[model samples]
Target: MPATDRSVTEALHKRRSVRAFTGQPVDPALLKEIFAAAQRAPSGGNLQPWQVTVLTGEPWQAVKDEVAARIAMGREGQQPEYDIYPRELTEPWTDRRFGVGEALYASLGIPREDKRGRLARFMDNYRGFDAPVMLFLHCSRIMGPPQWSDMGMWLQSVMLLLVEHGLASCPQECWAMYGETVRRTLGLDDGQILFTGLAIGYADEGAAVNRWPVPRAPLGEVIDWQGF
Candidate 1:
């Protein structure tokens, strides 16, 4: 099948954070087009702070091996390049976070008491869940919050582009934990910091983990209609 045949609204509703994927390879030309389309995302002052490194073929396998090895060794001598989550999560934010996690695990039939099972599954992030393509988003350390916001817009643009191309993706912040490994393995300079990793390929539609729809907060609770 070709890339998505849906309208933007339809794509928005159908897009998901897929955790499992088929090993099928995405055509290189299609990959080029999807990324080129993402270049259209809005940027702060047109600075376009986002930079991407896509890995496939032998390079992708090698990186996956290194990451999995590090993970298996208790992730020793490793620390996150940046704090992925806030130190203090409060109120509805905490509740929402917990709810989504519980929903995901329940869908996989992993019981709350299955610590090992959960942790092992969590490690799949390093393996990209066996997706055929992996991409890392990076930006220079000199960039500020506004530039970081631009990177986020770029990331969303890429994901929507993938959806349009009949592909799926999962934005894996977990990769931030292996910052040093990623930088060294990918030959990234010290000035560049990884914002996140993305796993892209065909989704395993039959997987139980992909079957459940995560909940979202109601608009009334999150928005204020001002002067409308």
Candidate 2:
């Protein structure tokens, strides 16, 4: 067994989605430790389905530049091989999604009519949301819906680990839009497909965007206990 600090649990509980990041570099050793934590996530029938490409330093800037260049060209870029959202969102789910969007845009001071502002902010996802570290997560092509669910668990594990390290992470499903180009540029194998990207780094405390706290549904709305 190894020694651990008491701050671990507290960090997990207090973790929040950080939209702004400081330019300071994250420690390589801690990054490695976080990946190790991500690997420990459970999988379906023990078939772990997560491959992560951690980007930093020059590699990160290279990817960022490529993405920006493509955007400047008047291209919508590659579409996701799979649909991120449901064909139809019903009732509470639809309302919840809209609520989150409204809250996020309000925080950024982008009014409901500001389409340009929204697009510009959305583009920032490809730029790692201005975070110095970007993690692209992929899974084998053979994976079905069950494995994708497994992938979500792995992503959650990684995000929690980032929080425990005093770092923040935003998992962007929109990254799949240009992930094909990112895959080819990064020289990844064909069997692997990017499911999402994560921006990880210390939160920029002075940034107003990170100051807004988005509300979450209560336990009663999300949980039901039948066994008593």
Candidate 2 contains a number of clashing pairs equal to 0
lDDT of 2 by residue, 1-228 (tens): 122323657766667777889888888888888777778889978898787888888988887877667667665655565778887879788988899888888988999899999988877777777899888889889998899999998888777777766778888877777776678767787888889888898889888778777788999998997996
Clashes of 1: 4
TM-score of each predicted structure versus truth: 0.96, 0.89
Task: Please write out the lDDT profile of model 1 over residues 119-182, one tens digit for every residue.
Answer: 9888787889889999999999999899989999999888888888789999998888888788
Highest lDDT, which number?
1
Q: Residue 25 deviation, candidate 2, in Å? A: 0.3
**Steric clashes per prediction:** 4, 0
How big is the positional error of residue 206 in model 1, measured in Å on the Cα after superposition?
0.7
lDDT, each prediction: 0.88, 0.80
Can you tell me which runs of candidate 1 are displaced by over 4 Å? none
The 10 consecutive residues of candidate 2 with the worst lDDT sum are: 1-10
